[model samples]
Target chain A: MERIPILRMGDFLLVTIQVDMHDELAMTLQDDLSDRISKTSARGVLIDISALDMVDSFIGRMIGTISGLSRIMDAQTVVVGMQPAVAITLVELGLTLPGVITALNVERGMSLLRERVQSE
Target chain B: MNVLRSGTQAVRIEQDVVLARQTARKLAVEAGLRLVDQTKLVTAASELARNTVVYGRGGDMDWEILEEERRKGLRLTFRDQGPGIADMKLAMTDGWTSGGGLGLGLTGAKRLVDDFSVESAPGQGTRVMICKWT
Candidate 1:
């Protein structure tokens, strides 16, 4: 079974999605991340989607679910590096990805996650 | 309209959905679609392909590159033999899903393309067609 690697950086979890993930992979990541957060007691999660070119409703829902789950688990999630075309397509697709914080890049995403974690 | 290129990809599983997106992106690029157009077409392909696998139980994505009056376009048709949709009006409505999804699959896919249409019945199968012109 293939899986997306979740890197632990201090109090945050960093996930750089570089694959064209299938539905199962997305579900696996959701379960895995929630499990990791509770086990490691992480404070924030930074997901880098810079490599992905498309984000349909399924993937969009997965991101929203992850964000909601993290909030309940006492962690913040900041999605970063969305391509301009993907953003346009996502909005046109009617998925606003509500509740999911976003940033321009990983550096800014990390800072945003840090701030959110500290403010909590 | 003339079909410059055409092929069919099976949409029987989750991985097939990803393959469908990749194929849509390649054909969209070959059709000379711009970046945003390519993304929209690929995103629409992803949504439709997943619907074929999930709601349709299994199907095929038939693709064609069309040329008409020096304009290029990509058309994709997702057909499934599974239990068909009973009500298209309710199915196309946003946030109304029978499978516990966001219910944006049908409606969202429609908004992302230049042309869209669907055909389904209670006992007959469903076929959804979408086209993006360059």
Candidate 2:
């Protein structure tokens, strides 16, 4: 059982995805994030996917689900560092992930998450 | 019977579909496709590969590297011998799904590749082919 480490930075949680994601691993991340969010009572989550070069329909849906779950748990999730290629693919797959927020990079995403959390 | 031939990457399990995406990406990059094209092809491959394993109950995907006078292309064909799709028109429709999914795999894969084709029957198997040129 492989695990993706979730790092805590201040009141925010940071996750950097580096593997070629499979269905089980993606689901594991969702479960791990949900538990971490409730346990730490984190205000925001910043997911950096710069190392992930590919995203499929399943992964796209998983992302949307994660963000929606985080919102219910009172945490704002901001995904950042999406490559141009991955963006194009997501659109083509008709998965805009309307429920999730995105930013250009980790710095911007962290700021955005903070702003959203503060506003909430 | 779904058999793996030489050079054919068989995607019979969930993990195989993940490997399929990796193989597609590597081939797309080796074909000199741009970053966006490579990503699109890889994504499409993932969707189709998952379909083969999930809906079709297991299948194999074959990779072909093509070089024409003008461009080089990578083509992938996914085949399955399980209960085949009965309605091509309905299956290709966006938001229409026989299985539990976003219902975007068939239609979305078509949009991402340069060439796409599907063949299936109610009792026969399904074969989907897609190619991207650079």
Candidate 3:
């Protein structure tokens, strides 16, 4: 099975989704991120989705689920690099992604994650 | 209206859903739709294709590029022989899903397209058709 790699970066976990993920792949990612958060004792999670052109209901739901899971697991999650087209489509699809944090790019996302983690 | 190209792709598993999105993107581009419009159509296709797999048990996505009176468009129809929707009215309602989804698949897809229609019965399978013109 294909898996999206989760990179350990100091106190944070970084996931850069570059492929057009299928449904199962998206679900697997949710599971893997949760496990990594617990094992690494990571303080934050940063997901880069610039490469993805679309965010359907499934992927949208997955993102929200990941955010919620990481939070209860004692980690903050920040999603970054959403394409403009994807943002437009996501809202039109009726997914506002409530309760999720977002940043413009990885650098900003990392800083935001750092700020949130430190302030907590 | 005239069909410039037409084809059918299976939606049996998770991967097929990706293919359906790719196919819709291609057709939308070929139809000369704007970037945002193309994204909307492809997103709608992704939603419907997934419903066909998860709810409809497996199905097919039929695509056609159309031209009429100087306007170009892309049309997609998702069909499945699996157990059909029992209450289409409730099924089409926003935030209502039988499959643990966000219930946006049907309602959201309908919002993303210019034209949309669905036909289904208890044992008669389901067919959802949507069109976008540019």
Off by over 4 Å in 3: none
The interface root-mean-square deviation of each model, in the order shown, is 0.5, 0.8, 0.6
**Ten contiguous residues with the weakest lDDT in model 2 chain A:** A111-120
* Residue-level lDDT tens digits of model 3 in A1-120: 899999999999999999999988999999999999999999999999999989999999999999999999999999999999989989989999999999999999999999999999
Docking quality tier of candidate 3?
A: high
Q: For candidate 1, write residues B1-134 as lDDT tens digits.
A: 99999999999998899999999999999999999999999998998999999999999999999999989999999999989999989998999999978999999999999999999998788999999999
| TM-score attained by model 1 | 0.98
The lDDT of model 2 is: 0.90
TM-score of chain A, every prediction, order shown: 0.99, 0.97, 0.99
- lDDT, candidate 1, at B48: 91
Q: How many backbone clashes does candidate 3 have?
A: 0
fnat, candidate 3?
0.95
DockQ of 2: 0.88
Q: Who is ahead in DockQ, 1 or 3?
A: 1
Candidate 1, TM-score of its B chain: 0.98
lDDT of 3 by residue, B1-134 (tens): 99999999999997899999999998898999998999999999999999999988999999999999999999999999989999988998999988788899999999999999999999999999999999
TM-score per prediction, in order, is 0.98, 0.95, 0.98
